[model samples]
Target: MNSQDETQIAVLRNLYAKQAHLIDTGQHEGWAQTFTADGEFHSPTYGEPAIGHDQLADISRRFSESAQQAGERHRHVIENIWVTECDGSSAQVRAYVMIVGTDIERKQARILRIVTNIDQLEKSADGWLIRHRKVEY
Candidate 1:
């Protein structure tokens, strides 16, 4: 609507792109930093929700290891990002995330999973951080 609003949306979009790259490249710590210290991630695929920085980073590490052992590379494509609600300090966003996996030896890529992510975000001095994310497959 306004210039400020447009800027915020663009920043949020960039956040998603940054997160995807971090996780895909096995930058576990950096990916976890996209969230707040007490952030939570809930997903059926993970069985248990990962809370706090330590748990978040651990999950990323495990994910990276699994993919590496399988001789596969994964990519996260975040699309249709919508800032459903936004106040100055907080926002609710939704997006579709498609996880694509590539088998290095086979040179084949396939869609691993498609999930919808609903996220609660907070604006801090450092910028926007995800407070909580719920993923539905």
Candidate 2:
């Protein structure tokens, strides 16, 4: 691809990394901010799609609490990110994510789930943000 395409891919990859880190570290607000104000997240695992910032943050908070209570630490590993479509102002991307969990006391890490993420992204003044995302097994 062209240099511009490479740069865009790098930026998108960085965004994914930031999102992963924010949620893993229990930065609920920061993780929700990775999406647009009206962003939507749909996943079978969540039962219902979280719409808007409040719901997004709530989901993240719940996830954090559940992990904490279980004495486990979770990490999201994003891989095989592909810019399936891009037109400067918007893009469609796909990625594979592996959710790894570690037992805090035992210090044992294991893969919990592997999911595919299909995302619709928009470029805004602030940068590229996820407009909608669908996660599936």
Candidate 3:
């Protein structure tokens, strides 16, 4: 791989790592900022309909509220990410994510879901942004 290729992969990895941290910490506001204004967030499905960034924000809000109400703690693990077509400014990516939730009251660990995402990323004047994201369960 060339230097340019290395740079692009590094950028994408950094951005994605930040997103994972934000989600794990329940920082919905910061997580929403990681995408472009018109970015879409979907499930891990290969062809699921997506809600826009604004809608995603709303969903995050509701999720946070519910988590607080239930006193739940969660850790989202993103693994086995493979990057293709790296071009310094954009690329296509695939990743597998597992969300584990723990209920303090019940003392039980549950595997909430498994997710896969195919994402298109672009780097603009501002920074690396997710141009299009398709998620499948």
Q: Mind giving the per-residue lDDT tens digits that candidate 2 earns over 91-111?
A: 999999998889999999989
- Ordered from best to worst lDDT, the candidate numbers read 2, 1, 3
In the range 1-137, model 3's lDDT, one tens digit per residue, is: 88877777777878888887886677887777777778787654313444557665665565566666767877667887788777767778988888777897998888878888789887789788877777777
Q: Is candidate 1 or candidate 3 better by lDDT?
A: 1
Model 3: per-residue Cα lDDT at residue 46: 19
Higher-TM-score candidate of 1 and 3: 1
What are the models' TM-scores? 0.97, 0.97, 0.82
Write down the RMSD of all candidates, one decimal each: 0.8, 0.7, 2.8
RMSD of 3: 2.8
Local distance difference test values of all predictions, in order: 0.93, 0.94, 0.74
Decoy 3 TM-score against native: 0.82
lDDT by residue for model 1 (1-137), tens:
89988899999999999999999998999999999999999999888999998999987888788788879998899999999988878999999999888999999999889999999999999999999999998
Q: After aligning candidate 3 to the native by TM-score, how far in Å is the CA of 19 from where it should be?
A: 0.7
Best candidate (score: lDDT): 2
